[model samples]
Target: MRIRATVAAVTGALALSALAVPAAQAGEAPTYRESAAAAFAAAHGTSDKAAFSTAAAAEMDITFSNFKIAQAVKVGTTNKVSTTVTYTLTHGADVDIHSEDFATGPYIYRGAFDTPDNMLFGDYAATCTDTSATTATCKGNIDVYPADGELLNAHAGTWKGGALALDYVTGDYADQGGLGTTLVQRYSKLTVNASPEPVVKGKTITVTGKLSRANWETFKYAGYTNQPVKLQFRKKDSSTYTTLKTITSNSTGELKTTVTASVDGYFRWSFAGTTTTPAVNATGDFVDVQ
Candidate 1:
């Protein structure tokens, strides 16, 4: 299968805003519906998790239906088939199997809590499990819990001209059988995806980069909206910043900045920015030509 890295888009500033303050701030992490929503979006972006979940369910016959091991083939031998095969053989005999299944649920995620907290009980609505030759489906809420070892953190603010942070707990389990360990992955860094700064004098060009869930922490309940990222720039040769720009990032975390070049001296430019909405923590830098 062709694997593509998925980028989670924060559609609005509100999503990032949910993680503005660390849950540890008030002796607990601050969470809102918006942050939960962001976390959900981030989880959906990880293709591996989704694929693993789908693959596991099919092999386990945990879906609505089950598949019988109709045939088995050995690499060099043809008739060495057994009446019944182990779970390892059904999925991939030679391949190392992990996680019994995959699931994302429970609306509320706490950053400060060391373990799972059912702040907002989440009910699974449906499940789709597919194999190369067979398909299965499950109706109604499935009994899914946060995988073990799942780490949840909240980071708020703007990084590189866009709101960036870990909204809430989002992760993939080594197994989805509700027994495997959960792995919390970081989203992409919030970025300003603009082209290189122009070198022409008085020719101000926009600066931008891309944002990902790894870069920003978010929540699963709250929806995100566009928010401005913080940026500071100065001439490489000069001591002080030549210009400071506050630009808003799109749903994809793209920012543009206009900057004019030096007319007299040979100059290089550098920039620094953050997406610290309620607070400033996430920061980044970029280069612009003379």
Candidate 2:
């Protein structure tokens, strides 16, 4: 994969490129082999600041399977999000996955696989443990920093995943895309308020709330519009909640509904979530029926 322009420019100057970027940068992050990474950079061609093309790497014998990234990843406005990735690696029996000259990991990316718009790799390499003679289980990190400008709000939604196999010693590597699909979502919030704290029996009590989520580009939280949200209720002494009804948020993301007051209870708005936003539930608003 061509190192997407954003990251390629940041690391291209240094001999050792993307894979071992930190390791080569005067002791920044750890890398498997700085020299190997440099060689891989040369052989694979990292000059294109626009993208680190994946077109050139010769195919290797290693194959990845059962790849799993999170079903959905929710990132907020200004915090680091860490998630795990797991996959099964099948390679030639003679290949030693643990060899010092070898490095491998799972990465999730956006846009085209061959020339992705963006890509995310773990700060550290995936830990692979042998499960059989020709197979192993690999687990790695999918680290994201909202403050780091690596992603844009427009990038939220569906993304694909794959694995990277590197051999610094031979200056050879392989990037296997299309391993899986996952959702990269914005962090979400839901709020609730019920009025007339104390009411007479059979009185109508109104509940109001709003649904919002992080907007990466603007660095603000904005209303999440026209989404189906559930109004749930629970008795003061009860531990469980029951769904009273499902309501859709307005264009401005406002929610309002009325329910008959029968007894003391708490009310809340719960969002089931969408591909671009995560599920959220408002804190319960309590009211008492006299």
Candidate 3:
């Protein structure tokens, strides 16, 4: 990425001219060469500033271990994902991890480093336990809701975990400095089944399904219980699905609901996922109304 406008200008000038000039005497008036030199200095000065910021951020030693999220986060769903972070701050001596100077919080950030846009998907304040003079363990819950306007929702896939160094902020503004680690985000899966095919018109049809999400610790899919799910239906030839009612999952993440058969249509389930898991929509189950 371009560091600054002055850097770009100096770069172009360097490409056009290869000659080098000595610094002008103190009594001599400034010339075009001095202007070019100033531009070059401005460009390197910006780089030095960035390097200093990075070094300062590095001083706040942060690490993530045993960081676990119960399930995969679904898009558009508000999931409360739990996290555990360990950190240590070294500034000459061991700095207090709990000090107000450090804005130590758990967050999910986008993987791209090309630009400083909406890199943060979810950020949550954490409660830390001091483990040593320079180290601490923090635990907290992050509420992740990736809606249509959210950048994370635009890209449905894995997101990495990290910690934000809010301590670098001054007044209302703060440079975004955080340490990112290798942690993969999980995605949720939902399924639906409609029974009593070829039912008479106006007859009650039973709809059942399950809501399960990926478990990073176990590397398996498990039922997500006590969560709300929506039952939607669409006519056979219709492209849109309308919500019929809301249902909750049982202890096993099993879903059951009943709807009256009106016409040949498809039945499905849609889950607005939580912070930990991404949102999911089940495939439609078609039923022919006799």
Top lDDT hit: 2
Task: Provide the lowest-lDDT 10-residue window in model 1.
Answer: 158-167
Looking at model 2, the pairs that clash are 1-52, 1-54, 2-52, 2-53, 2-54, 3-52
Rank candidates, TM-score, best first.
Answer: 2, 3, 1
- On the 0 to 100 scale, the lDDT of residue 234 in model 2 is 96
Judged by lDDT against the true structure, how good is candidate 1? 0.29
lDDT of 2 at 100: 79
Looking at model 2, residue 173 earns an lDDT score of: 62
Query: Per-residue lDDT tens digits of candidate 1, residues 116-157?
Result: 221221232122333343332222211112221122333222
Candidate 3 positional error at 50, Å = 24
Local distance difference test values of all predictions, in order: 0.29, 0.74, 0.53
Task: Give lDDT tens digits, candidate 3, residues 191-216.
Answer: 98998998999999999999987554
Which 10 consecutive residues of model 3 have the lowest summed lDDT? 1-10
TM-score, predicted candidate 3 vs. hidden true structure:
0.42
Off by over 4 Å in 3: 1-176, 179-185
| TM-score for each model | 0.28, 0.80, 0.42
Cα lDDT of model 2 overall?
0.74
